[model samples]
Target: GAGVSQTPSNKVTEKGKYVELRCDPISGHTALYWYRQSLGQGPEFLIYFQGTGAADDSGLPNDRFFAVRPEGSVSTLKIQRTERGDSAVYLCASSPEAGGPLFEQYFGPGTRLTVT
Candidate 1:
């Protein structure tokens, strides 16, 4: 079975532009997560989706950030307005079930976004 995979491994864009980062979760995994990692820090939770709806999106930094998991297997993270501050490594993870002490999340190679 294929693991979680993120597209465009690296992205470079100008400030104020829009960008979409994509993620494909492992087959049969019902839960997916999006995270952002800045320099010198750990991955910061951005959003979590269970099934076709977002279960937790409290971690989204601002109105400019949005994500959707329309069919529950693929997710897209959309940034309305890119900023230098947004330059970071965007990570995607998936698990067999929603978050809990029992299930473990499998992470994908992050998509590095650089706003120039």
Candidate 2:
């Protein structure tokens, strides 16, 4: 079974451009998370969706970064203005609801975004 998947393994764009990253989590998983990692640093949590709504969005840097899980399975991460400082690998992970033995999450291969 597919664990978690992301399209466009790499993306390149000019500064000020907009980009949307997609993540398709494993079927039946109810908890999904998004993260961003700059070079030489750990991944920073972005946003999390427990079902059809965002559970914790405090990790989003600003209004420019947003995510949606309208159907409770697939999710999309939207960036308003792409900047060189935003260049990094965007990651997605999925797992069962918290407080369960299956709370361990599985991460997808990150999508590397580059703003030229």
Give all TM-scores, in the order shown.
0.97, 0.95
Which residue pairs overlap in candidate 1's backbone? none
User: TM-score: which candidate is best?
Assistant: 1
For model 2, which pairs clash? Answer: none
- Model 1, 1-116: lDDT tens digits are 68899998999999999999999999999999999999999999999999999989999999999999988789999998799999999999999976585889999999999999
Once fitted onto the true fold, the runs of candidate 1 whose alpha carbons sit more than 4 angstroms away are: none
User: For each predicted model, how many residue pairs clash, with residues at least 3 apart or on different chains?
Assistant: 0, 0
Model 1's alpha-carbon lDDT is 0.94
lDDT of 2 by residue, 7-92 (tens): 77899989998999999998999999999999999999999898998989999999889899989999999998887989999999
